[model samples]
Target: MKKNVVIGFLGTQMDAGKRRKWRPSVQLCEHPDFPVERFELLHDARWRSLAGKIKAAIQSVSPGTEVLLNEINIDNPWDFEQVYGALFDFAQNYGFDDEREQYHVHLTTGTHVAQICWFLLAESRHVPAKLVQTGPPRNNTPDIGTLQVIDLDLSKYNALQQRFERVSGEYNTLLKGGIETRNPVFNALIERMEVVVSNSDAPLLLVGPTGTGKSDLAARLYELKLQRRRIKGRLVHVNCSTLQGERAMSTLFGHRRGAMAGAQSERGGLLKEADGGVLFLDEIDELGLDEQAMILHAVESGKYFPLGSDYEVTSRFHLIAGASRDLAGLVAQGKFRADLYARLNLWTFRLPALRERPEDIAPNLEYEFEKVGKMLGNQVAFNADALPAYLRFATDPSTPWPGNFRDLGASVQRMCTLSPRGRVTLPMVQDEIATLQRIWKDAHADADAVLLAEVLGEGAAQIDLFDQAQLASAIRICRESKSLSAAGRRLFAVSRLEKKSRNDADRLRKYLEKFGLDWAQLVQ
Candidate 1:
């Protein structure tokens, strides 16, 4: 007898037209022996067109098999659980015959909502379900198969584990073995969190500069917590910068029906949605003082009153907050509340900047190269020159990397994508460095110019003629080419005499001396 299967595609819209028809087209081959029935539970009316196409496909595959294409209006948060429950009920009532055959739910789509709902239903019913995705073929095309699902809540945890393993493998492969070979500081923090996560429910504060992977670390912690508990709860990540005024309250504590003018129905806030797991607050410094107090109260008491509702909702979510700037500074400036800071500082871990971890730069570059190459479907590799140049750029103490690892990653990706023959050269590195310098100068043009003027005195006027940026650019070019003429040619593309005659070389020399560039040994 053929196995009974129920598949749920859980996203806002599940219309056959918008759906990746090719994905389902390939998915149908999974159960070649069993008679498969397809169902599309769309959360929006917009997906009707896609639904029709899916119905047609089902008809082609199995002429008489029942295919249910339904639309659910989900304007509020409560509707999700209700809609999900109804879908499962509908599936069991129409498709599954428990006495005749074993029913298995297969979630082929990569929608997180569907995955969560299916997980809950599968666990409740004690039914076997598997997640399947397409994998690259041994030869050319990609193949489809089931990835491991040790436990239902293990998805996030497993993903982090896999990522860690992959990154570790790349480090070992590239670095061979050296002191501080891996990101020991980051790994050690993770280890400490692993020990503390299960023991305490206090909020975790991941303090680090931007692009230091604070968000990533927070996610891994959430997964680790889930893996430890074997519980079902969603990992909800919210950027505090995106939430403003009323939206902040609604987003955190949820809203009641008619709570405000536009609130038509009741909704579950992120805290409630993330109950039993983790709520990662990125850019925590951006959160307003009132919101910070509310968050602190929730973290302290695990009780919050939803907007426009008298009833108080409770949460069991592990709060993990991250920020690019110093929270203590924000507290000092009266931007952030001290109480909230105290609560969040329970298990604080400050990630070291990329420049501090020069050992990990090469591995990070290699891993990033492979990642970008796979995404772009290109065979890209970094030449030996690329690593040294990137290392110098990333670890330069004088260089200001406001974006940190993210900026480095993006730069590497751009270089790989734009490089000819997938080979990064010294010129490519120089070009990128020049571009970054331009951006930096543009951002700090006023301040930089003032600083240069203050130092250069009478020469400051000449410095002012060409913005501080231009002055800096001229110096960089001169150093790179080891000749004023060549640097001028590269920077302005002007005739050698014109570039030299502009007094740019003299101004650059004076400015360099005034800034103590000689002391810094900036000039080669």
Candidate 2:
């Protein structure tokens, strides 16, 4: 068995009481559980005599134990920095032989500041020892004292582990802007994102359709990093789509005076501005190949040559790229550099589109309304019936939310802006529904027009764009169904429930006749 060694501070006051018979260091040496074969006592230069008395008492109580005194000089034992530095230097230079001896740091005899420093050093493994705390004999009993050994490894403690888990959950909630998302996939994504953000400084690629909160998530992540002191500089956001040609180079990499035509002054680029911070590149897929190459170089090496400058500039910045388009597909098409894609592909998170997560629509709707209220400096709310009516339409499968969250946010803003007395009534919701339906219809009109031409050939030109969506949908449904009644029932699933006759075939026939087409002709 290895010999046991105890290292501690000599309590100048506590060890030298009025009688000077009982001392914490002596108690540690005499404790049966500790089996201390050696005691290394730390003391200030002014406390040499007191330390000598404590060392002699320890040796007298435990004759087999050897005592060594270490002098640690600090102006104030209560000064945290000085105490910590002294303890740190002592631990660094102390020749500890782990193979031959077991070490324990006694925490009973030092200033509170010194004790805290010892705990920090031990917990961080700077001391490579267990902590031993001693208490005086209770009721003047003829006992040496009470002794407790504490291991600083936090993983062994259940309460600390639970607290860490709770903190991680809070981080996930904060990442979602405090909205309790109901979608399991989205919740899981946020949880993983929180872990990634907490542990990594690598470039992050946020892949999702536009209006799915990529930019907002990136900004929130930057804010979290700022709060954690991981970043000391500002978040520099750049929309790659807005940059083009030489201007793109100059804007991203900066320009020197007279480096190129129309260049008059020295410029520090966005990368340099992002030093010690984060660079959020939105719509990064829009960047040209040459710019992509430079970005890869800068990301990999943190060094780049500015526009028309032969000298290299260095900017250490964390990167986060947002892409609405499939960068892998772009790479396959030779539009994006494969090497750069490889770098960013390491940590890729795809945000689900708003339409994909309908369960989130209600809560997000409330959040958007709150945001609009703050922005407008007044609160707006929907009437009881109007709120459900709008929610029903918004969450419907047939609703085309082409712009995702942006579409919903804009719709809410419009309703709030036009609401009478800050209350959105049923009529206003009905009108807004019609407006949104019209907008989506117009947005899909071109695609519908193509399908109409395929069905009608020369006759397609006669149909207006406004009617093409409805007519094309009808034609496509008629072509897909085995009969006109099946097609009509599907197209009027809800409306037919209200009709007593339910003669969907007749209704469908008349609708087709209005468009100068029959079910047979559509299927043919």
Candidate 3:
């Protein structure tokens, strides 16, 4: 017969000072008289708390069972060394038990901090311990054994490892080519694209602020499909904004020799170039109404006539279009064709702004550092302080980032080039931050005051003396103001009034100094 398994649950709290307090609860299966003496306790504060609870539970269940207790405090970095000292001390003082012990741990903490720390401690010491958790009971019963303990799933771990490898590989490839991943928005966008590409064959529409890497995603998706053998053709990228009138039609539809003044011979258009592959049209909304009609026809019926030619050509390719503005909004204004809008809107992915995902900052920073290092031919690392500043800068809800990722990449490259000895230091980071803050202040000083006053009360107007914290507060206010301003004329008028506040030369100068803004840039 198999022995019944038991699970022990533990919880702990850590103070601001990093001191730990452990609270434990244990539940068991059959075999109440099983000797608790077979179990050994690790000496960390958290484990000690767990051990105390386990001991109490054993005493309640079976009073005669004997157990040994060990105490360890891991409050600092040096505590690991002390743990080793304690282990050696234990070996020197008490001889090892002849019989190996069977131990089970059921961690019930909502956060993974203690559990991960405990896991590291166990692994470092080569101790064999089973980890467990108390999930919802499978069956509804008071005594039906709701506890669960199992080995960690290595396959999930391996999958995550593979994901990180791919991310790192891409980071290195982009970095080597002098690109930076400063926007956290791209990570989420990539995940979204992966799902979109895998699940649907419909044309994908990438929409976001300008410079948010719509074209980049298009190229990457094309490459990704090729790698997976999902598509047979290459990715053909074209900037629709660059093609206008006759030029736009000729470039998109192809032309024969002597088709136009510049045409010396027959040439294939982007549609033919991307046959069986993907045709990525950037700034698709910029295509004139006529051009949009032509593209829409081609998209609807894979057929188009070449410029200066009467014969129609058949084309088949995946269509991926991108725009910096909302196509629906453009349609409402009659600037974009409704039919083209309907076609592209079949599948759409909206990329979030950079300020949305703060957690992605570290990874992006690491990626940027590696990129800069490769470019400069020297190892570069962000100072510990630099990350926090970068996050604060990137995530400020008020900063418009009109250029998005392109702007951020340029900023990071500038920081790397300006850093002393190729190492980003706290002061260097601060200086860059000061410069950025100033630029932002000067650019939006008027708009900031108007928006700030509206959201934060009229008192906000009188409190323009800015610090990093205050600037952050003002940014939040500005974002809210922009949203509210969209409602009606009164609010719009308020925004106009706010814009005027920054125009006061003396007030603007003080505002610039307080926020570390460059007044000349603002004036210009």
Choose the strongest candidate by lDDT. 2
TM-score, each model? 0.51, 0.67, 0.50
Model 1 gets an lDDT of: 0.66
If both were scored by TM-score, which would come out higher, candidate 1 or candidate 3?
1
Give the candidates in order of lDDT, highest first: 2, 1, 3
| TM-score-best of 1 and 2 | 2
Which of 1 and 2 is the better model by lDDT?
A: 2
**Deviation in angstroms for 335 in model 3?**
1.4
Write down the RMSD of all candidates, one decimal each. 24.0, 13.0, 22.4
In candidate 3, position 50 carries an lDDT of 52
> Which pairs clash in the backbone of model 3?
43-71, 43-72, 438-516, 438-517, 450-498
Off by over 4 Å in 2: 1-27, 32-130, 133-148, 153-166, 446-524
Q: Which sequence of candidate numbers ranks them by TM-score, best first?
A: 2, 1, 3
| lDDT (0 to 1) per candidate | 0.66, 0.90, 0.61
Query: Model 3, 1-524: lDDT tens per residue?
Result: 22222222223442111332222233332133332333344445656655676666656655655545656454652445544455445435644322454444445542354455445434543334456554323456343234455554445577777996786566444422333444545555555667567556678898887776677777877766665566898888898879977888888888998989989988788898888889999999888998888888888788888888888898888889999888898897689999889989977888765555445545655666677778878776777777677677676776566556666676788788887586777777777777766776776566656654544465555563554345544344333432322322322344456664433334434544664443343323
Model 2: pairs clashing at backbone N, Cα or C within 3 Å: none
lDDT tens digits, residue span 377-480, model 2: 88999898999999899999888798999999999999999974999999999999999889987776667768888878889898877888899888878887
